[model samples]
Target chain A: MNRRCSLITILATAAALFTGCEREEIRVYSVAKETAEAPAKAASDTPTPAANAPRPQLAYTLPAGWQDAGPTPMSLANFRITTDAGEASVNITPLASMAGKEALVVNMWREQVGQKPLAEGELAGALAPIEIGGEKGQLFEIAGSRDGQTVRIITAFLHRGGASWFYKLQGADAVLTAQKPVFVEFLKTVRIKEPGSAPAAEVVKVADPAPAATAEFKWKVPEGWQTLPAGQMQVAKFAVPARDGAKAEVFVSVFPSDTGGALANVNRWRRQLGLEAVDEAGLKALVTPLEGAPGAMLVDLKSDAKAMLGAIVPREGRWWFYKLMGDTAAVTAERAAFIRFVQTAP
Target chain B: MKLLWKFFTSLRLTVWTLGFAIALVFLGTLAQVHEGLWDGQTRWFRSYFVLRKAGDVWWVPPVFPGGYFIGAVLLLNLLAAHLKRFQLTWRKAGINLTHFGILLMLVGGLATDMYSRESVMNLREGGTRFFSEATREHELVFIRTLDDAREEVVAIPTALLRTGAEVRDAKLPFPVKVKSYWVNSTPDFRAPMGKNAAPLSDKGIAKDWDFSERPETKGMDDRNLPTAILDLGEHGVWVVPSWASDELLIESVKRTYTKSVGAETAAGMAAKMAAPQEVEAGGRKWRMTLRPTRHYNSFSLTLLKTTHEIYLGTSTSTNPQGIPKNFQSRVRINNPTKGETREVDIYMNNPLRYEGLTFFQATMGRDEIVDVGRSGLQVVRNPSWLVPYLSCLLVGIGLTVQFLYHLIGFITKRRATVAV
Candidate 1:
């Protein structure tokens, strides 16, 4: 139930990212022979609607001599499409990337046209609205006569999730227009396996939180000092010890669950010692084993947030950590109590 | 007489002058939309010489504009008589700061106008500059190239050059015959020709001249003087000469490679070729350059990078268009004898100041390609910058005292009113 709840929350956030903000990207799935050559065929029994049979989920005609580009795990699909029409390239982005407004789609067009993203009225001439694949999307086109050369570019949006697939066609006016009928035909070809019946994503099991360690230490508090709960980014705050102001805090939060993982966490801390940015693996390289937890690793660092020390322990299926560290001076004075806090916390 | 003096020393002059100054600036700014920024000065700038010397009344104000000589005198006069107004308290000191800042700014303008020297120093990368020549907004130079001499520089007045195709200027090394003149310009290879060509009837500034192009070189060959590009027709036919000037001096060097008598090897160096450009008008030539106003310098700059960042997908401050988020350049500095060179890593907000030349990362542009790879640097050298600072300080002090005096007076008056 907990796992399901987590998945649902992630899904909700991803959905809101699209439906809530100024996002205009449309995810376009293409079976063109040009790229991402999946088993899907354009010549399949998928029939063209009679005038208007309420439109297909997604459909588009693959121009001649185009093959799938390659596997793109991050994209809406594993591959892409290409055409002879002035090297028109098409990629279907996933809905997770776009925040879900049509302007973002036009903004993407602005990027290509060498212009700043236009506000609604700014690109009224360029971005025309249209519906494709049963979902509303935007249409964008640009043209100019420069140095005696006339050219035109066109792009259509196919939005879903927090992402948009932009079907861009650019070239000489004649060249781009020649490919238009075929491009729209390709738009008609978009389809996914039944809605809500999507395949379950691969999952890795996670273990429960571990028992705390008993450290030997204590701290002196002022006669009456009130402590408050942190509202956001709690882990980033670490209390400072008394001296000048003598007021401080130390907090922690872990993600991807491996006690937030040991070796990587430890090395990340060491990076604060006049080191350079590193990858997770490099972080793992700087680990020292913990006496109580054999497979555990530990490290320390000082970043923009200040002094930090953390440890990583392997949990059920991932890594977890009981990391504790904060401001240099403040953490130094309260290190014993912090160790005590971590030892007794959930 | 004392009452008249009081009236003359009142805030009326200050207010009027401030309003006129703002209006002039506003008009100048609005005119820039079409006249172009470089051309903006023409619409509002009625140079004293143009009005006073030329006796042009429309541009001249019969009244007064409170510039340094006018505004300062009135202000100082008022300051002398208005001494009792300020009670001289610390509380009023803060208000005085604001006025002092303004005064300092005014004084600074006067100092700058009298002593500052603004000039153009075009240097290619890897070059250095020593002395820079100050320029006027619009002046003409007759590019005089003698049959035997290297090159002779002659200044021409633009007004005369603008009249007819055949302007007969006496200063030309070879009787300066206006072959063509253009106020604004674009390329027109369409000139009819044997050796010279005919000028086209273009309506705009770029259209006003006979257009022709030579190979785009980085040296004198490309530096053009402000011209009234004329059509000096032959006989009854006005012949617009289709030619280009390098604005350079080409002197021959004695060379061992000379194969014949009188055959010369010109010491064709860019620096040697560099000559002052002139404007020809009303049978006279005038050498000209623009003023180095505020931060604008005649030198060219290029931005190395402009990137925008976002935080947690909430707000993005990207340089969506290419206006530039920062200024960076590999500037080509040049001095008359010191030569040309560059200083890299001059970034935005951080300006490079050397000699009397200061280059600020003002904006960006490209030489030819639209929407890419160009930079603008505002170079300034005003002698009176310090004056404004001092003026501001004094005004601040005065305002501070005056404010406290008024506060006390207000309290006393309130008490009296209540008592009554």
Candidate 2:
């Protein structure tokens, strides 16, 4: 009896072990609630013309005798200039960044004009510095033959509002030469508006209820501040009255944690103020600790005309943006108030 | 016990199982021409019993013997042979080690086959992603944008969606009823007053274009563009894969409308006012679309840039016959929970392994349009990935020791013969 029992027990244990090593169970994942958010739209997906749409008045004015041909997919503004010799076309394109070296762009134009690309040493002689919209820019003029007709292209490159703008006028040599002076006058009329001024459509009063108690932090609003309806991509908006009757705005927004991180957000704010982008080390120099909120950072950036006081607070897998931006004097006056509001959050 | 031992340790059984496995692999490779790699793998290599479809009909009687059966028999034979014949003698030690290594490799393969998951992460330049999506399967996603910058997403796997199937979940505010579903389809457009023309849905961007189901394609590069007509009661919308973006659909609608009206109006202005496919329920707005099912990770990867180098003297991309010199992705891995941030370059043959997941640079292409670089990384997770390495080491060591032992014995015998 003992021998039989031992044999049966050994077989049972072996069988059990083999069965225990069966295939892994198919995983059934439940929905994860209140986690990190979806990513923001890609930088490339942000249309260049739409980026300038919020400040349409900042665009260049059409020269006299130039008919507006409207915007194209790649160009923000398109116009047709009619002359006795022939008709010329003008395209104003604003891009998020310079995609390549200046030489590559010049070569691309040369190729379009049916002319050979200039060598490295020849590039210096081909480009000349010119002033457009109160900013120094590069100008290039190339003449070539296309379809047995003399064609000319006059191109200008300008940097403004943290973006690269290209203005090109291409047509018959006679027409392009005649329209060159008018194009220069058109470039001078370009206006880059100060950041933080509300778009004309958004200047109307919009009633927005205060935030609910679902948030972990609460704050007390200062006097003479009116809450406006929070638009898309914004959590809250507050209008602060200025002595000159123009209002400086304080707004709150939030994004997924590390959604471009602190440096990218700071550079985006600087871009809004028409300032140059900074490197990581420069970002650190611009950031300071918020007085009461541990692990929170405050960034103060200013251009010649506009300034921004912003705070970035990381919490619960989300990053919050609290900013007050407007005229230099207005932003400076509200800097302490913005800091106090952020510090008083509980 | 003796009878069981004899059956398990039989050399005939091992030979039979192995031979059947070889035949099955041969037949599976031939089947891949008709069925794609994914379907062929699931039907042949992954299943316990291989079902032979009758005349291309799936719902027919099946024939016998699959990969799982052969593998199981082989495993049993190996274990039983070891138990019956294994001894601790020095002469048999090498054989024992070799057999053990082989057994480990078989088990490891089984584990990997059962548990491994593969997905792809696609990123545009300067884009970041926290999840990877399965290349073969798709899901219908309902996204609700919350005020706190977070999104509440309810995903339904494509396998569960069929014609006339009602999908209801506690997490969803409203039940979605699928009216029609097609694995592959093409949009059929006609004049508004054409014969046999179907009415358009009031919601989706392609409201004017009718849909016609097409047979699933078997070409290697062809992808199944699934489309479905779903009813949310008061609203109805059409759902297609991510390749069919809202803008593309709106453009198609505008083109078809212009053709019908025989006018060349500015379609761009009309496209701007196109209504998006959105549904309102439970005091919130939800955007519904069909996308690949995503596998979220705790960490996030940001693609700093992707570079694709071509061969010299070629204006186009690298020649199809010749490999590119270099295709690389510079990515930054950030794990806030662990407080770790590092930049790693992933390129051909060199993969980044982190948290048991291996990321391989799979392909490089443009991001929807030319001039924007996009990188595709293949992410694989297999808990048994280390098994093959260990098995190879053990097998090599055992074979070396066995060879040396025989060589020494031969030398001793030769010397003794010379003395004699």
Number of the top-ranking candidate, with DockQ as the measure: 2
Best-fitting candidate, measured by lDDT?
2
lDDT tens string, model 1, A218-334? 433323323444322122233445545534454444333542234434554566444576676766565556545546555656655456556564534444444445446654565
lDDT for each residue of candidate 1 in B1-420, tens digit (9 for 90 to 100): 445445444577557656766766665555455445543453344222112224333444443332333434434533432342434456656554655566456446545655565554432222233323333323344333333433343444444454443444444323344544544333322211001132343322222223443432222213323334443232122222211222211111112111111121111111111223344544544332211111222343333333232233443366334333444566544333356456455556677776565656554443221233444445567656567657766776667667767888899999999999
Candidate 2 lDDT tens digits, B1-420: 767656767899889888888988887777776787877777777777876665554532367576666776787778776766668887877787888889898878888887788999988777777888887667787777755656777788777678898888876778788887788777543221122133446455454345667897766567676777787776555544343433334455445544322222214323332334677788888777676678889888988888888677565455553547789999999988899999999998999999889999998877543346789999999999999999988888788778877888899999999999
**By TM-score, who's the top model here?**
2
* C-alpha DockQ for predicted model 1: 0.00
Give the TM-score of chain A in candidate 2: 0.41
Error of 1 at A245 (Å): 99
How far off is residue A1 in model 2, in Å? 19
